[model samples]
Target chain A: MSAADAIAVAGVTKVFGSGNGQVAAVDDITVSIRKNEFFTLLGPSGCGKTTLLRLIAGFEFPTSGAIWLDGADVSDTPPFRRPINTVFQNYALFPHMTVEENIGFGLKMLNRPKAEIAERVAAMLKLVRMEALAGRRTNQISGGQQQRVALARALAPAPKVLLLDEPLSALDYKLRKEMQIELKRLQAETGITFIFVTHDQEEALTMSDRIAVMAAGRILQVGSPREVYDAPADRFVAGFIGESNLLPGTVERVSGGLASVTLSVGGRIEAVAPDGFSGGGPATVVLRPEHARLMPAAGAPEGAIAGTLATAVYFGTDTHYHVRLADGSDFTVREQNRPSVEARFHAGDAVAAVVEPRAARLLRERP
Target chain B: MARPFDVRRQRGFTVVAAFCFALLYLPIVVLVTYAFNAGESIANWEGVSLRWFVAAAGNAQVIDASIRSLQIATAAALIATTAATLAALATTRTAPYRGQAATFAALNLPLMVPEIVTAVALLIVFARIKMATGYTGLGYLIAAHTAFCIPFAYLPIRARLDGMDLNLERAAADLYATPVRAFRHVTLPLLWPGILAGFMLAFVISLDDVVITEFVKSGGQETLPTYMLGQLRRVITPEMNAISTAFLALSIVVVTVFFLVSRKRD
Candidate 1:
């Protein structure tokens, strides 16, 4: 355990129900969040990301482990006893209170002086840029304004940690984009630990300093957005973070921290192998859509996979090429639509797909 | 260019609705109209006059009974609503346990059984208490009304508590509010309208209760309804109609307020 960590979830498992009906909502997860880090838990529905956030927020107690906040074991404590606050999925603002009052609520609950409450509330209002709407009821404000108010209210308490549960899912697209930038700025300005939970990979990739990708109540990978995206730890992480083409292959050899794999689709490619060496077995090669290119078979690089160009569709910013590899599986490739990045190969042409040396990764298939 | 589904267009629909309204309001309408009759006879209206209203007001028994009714209603409504609020929070706020359904059924027992049966049961139970204590006061009547009005106070409050977002309570707790403080600051204010509506319902229910009051009350404890019953047995006059009209108006006013207060905003 590091002293710099703001929170540590040590082998926590939260189980719901009893006896035969039991199901673990958070299954044996142990992770540490650094102080002032914008940490995100990204997963699909029923992945227990929200449940883990609740465990950190002290709403749900772990079935078999402890939660440490600032060097204190707080798993047995109630939510009110902890110094953490949450921005709920629905905002959960007091409907009867005005925006100013909602923001001042946590301060008032802490029995801060009335003058201090007013000053802090004013500062928060300006921080979220809701000074003009201070007197308005929370229901009276627009959705985006309500989101800002939720942020201001959660941050006004200067909590040691803030837990956000899909706070932007209710907002429209434009507002969500705006709030993503606003949230990062707030986290930086406040310098408080923010543990956010969402299923949207792009949101997590864009706003998070580090992300824990979860599935089926188990965290699959934890790394920076780029680390988890460009060099995913395994099959699930690679598929979830972005578009990936997983091709079956056998590991040929491991040398110089890279493994060359012989593809079943009639080619061989080199990939930066994962940690730990001296292994030779069946492995899958991960090729990212944006990392590959299409060219005529005659001009292709050595050992490049030869394929037939099946379809090329323009997507404004990029063109998507669906080429059928030798085994007749679709080998998808995406190219940026810059002037020099025009699609030269059309459908029904003999083409070869070239993968950059760094773009491929070897995942050893579990026996 | 399709027609909307209108119930009126169906055969016998308008007839059935009109018949229902007519049956429900026809008696009250007849009584209200006769309350303004100038003559002493309730069956014949001589002309429009304020004589019956004035006579009813001037009668000392009517005034005494009216005052007693108001006092009992206020006390019963306040106590019943308080008890019902606590009961509602207890039942709905916590996780369900064994016997929770039975508790709910018991709370609403007075409404299910016939009023006469409840009155008779109370009569039997109170007879023993009275004989043992040798006490006869309005306390018994108030106690009976309170018991009967509890379910009246409970339904609206329980519905409101059910419809409320439970996350608001969690949010309050996350903001460092103690359980009591969360209820005081967040839960209570949102539940205020429901409490008010429940109180009004309990007030109206207790104000006009007859069978229980008849069985439970001691001597000189005649509320307006019981007093009217006594007058009906003695003589038939427009004064009774005036009192009934006033009672009907009071109920309508309270129920209207209850309806307005219980309207959900969100």
Candidate 2:
């Protein structure tokens, strides 16, 4: 483990139940979270993201492997002894405690002096901008206020790391957006390593400095948000991060760091092959909908794949055209809504979907 | 104001409810009224007076029995509530084990069995034990009451624990509370209302229990309810009504206090 790594989870595996009913909740996994980085574990439900967070929080003891915090093996350390705190998904604020009391509880547990606790709690309340509601009980506050209180309480201890388990999932869209910025600001101000867990791709992309995309108790890929979204490691990661048009094909040629793959849809497209490509092996070309452009087939450039528009979906910011390619595979091309009325393509319009070679990624097919 | 339902339908429902209330409360009202009757005969009210109340208060046996009953109920409620709380925590908080269903069934057995059967079974066991050791005291009554009251106490405690979000306890631990501290600070405070409710329910059940107390108590260890039964078997008087009224009042006060306490500041 590096000196700057705040947490290092090495080969951790957690299995639940026994015999035929046994299931691995967290398979053998290793990841080093750096100090003061906004790292995220992103996956759908049952993908073990929450379980990994819980394991780090010391809520669950791993069946094997070690968890290192600040260069010390804290695998067996109880949650209270760890220099970490969690903001629960439901914002589990103590219903009986006022916002101030809730925020001060950790300091009290740490045996801090009453005066220091008060000052710290006041500072936290101010940080979350909840000073006015500090005296209100948890149940008396709104959902957003309660979320702020939860954050304040977890942050008041000034732990080395803060774990958030989809803390913004319960908030409305507007509130979630606001808190996303607020959380980023808080992370910067506190300079605490944050391990945020969320299934929301947008939230992860917006807030995290780096993200680990997990599925089925395994880490599929780990990279910065931009790297993971633009150059995913596998079909799962590619599909999970955002909307993508995966064109299945067999590798036709490889040169330098790029490969030409003969698309199953009767086209040959050049893409960046992350792993060196071999001839005659199945591969998939991942094209983000926004990267593919819809153009009239009559005047289309070379390397443009011909297709007939199947549907036109008008999203306020952009229009998406679902085009059926020659080989019966469908791909969607999104275009920003232009001010000109004549730029729109209708269903059944013959068009060529063109994607730049640099924008497409070639990945090996999963067995 | 206009009625939501037809007048006839409302009247019918009111009549049925009133009839049920009368069925439930009229006998108790009559008994209470006769406790203050000036006449010796409980059936005939000559005028209202506190003569029976005075007699009941002055009776040594009634007083002793009341004190004994209070002691038994308090002891039984404490033991039962503690045991029930532990049982609830184990069954609800822990992961499922092989015999979890059986354990639940065992806890509920006392409630499922007939009271008379339980009383007899306890009597036979106590009789054997007493013959072996010659130890007979209020302990037997307390033990029997505690056994019978566990299920009553367990249900509400379990429900409360189940209704509680486990996340709060996790949050407590994350906030630097140890397991024990988390239980003390988070679990216990949140569970107080259920525990208090369980205690009051157990206390009332033990206080009002007659069959179990009769079978379990040794000589001169009669609880108030068993003592009242003995008194009624021999002679029916306004004093009996007075004792019953006082017992009812005590139970109401306990329940009302519990209600108020649980409802406060939530």
TM-score winner: 2
What tens-digit string does per-residue lDDT give for candidate 2 at A156-214? Answer: 99999999999998899999999999999999999999999999999999999999999
Listed in order, the DockQ scores are 0.72, 0.80
**Could you tell me the TM-score of chain A in candidate 1?**
0.97
Q: Which stretches of candidate 2 lie over 4 Å from their true place?
A: A275-282, A340-343, B1-12
TM-score attained by model 1? 0.94
State in Å the error of residue B141, model 2.
1.4
Please provide TM-scores, in order, for all candidate models, with all chains considered together: 0.94, 0.96
In CAPRI terms, model 1 is classed as medium
Q: Pick out the ten consecutive residues of candidate 2 chain A with the lowest summed lDDT.
A: A274-283
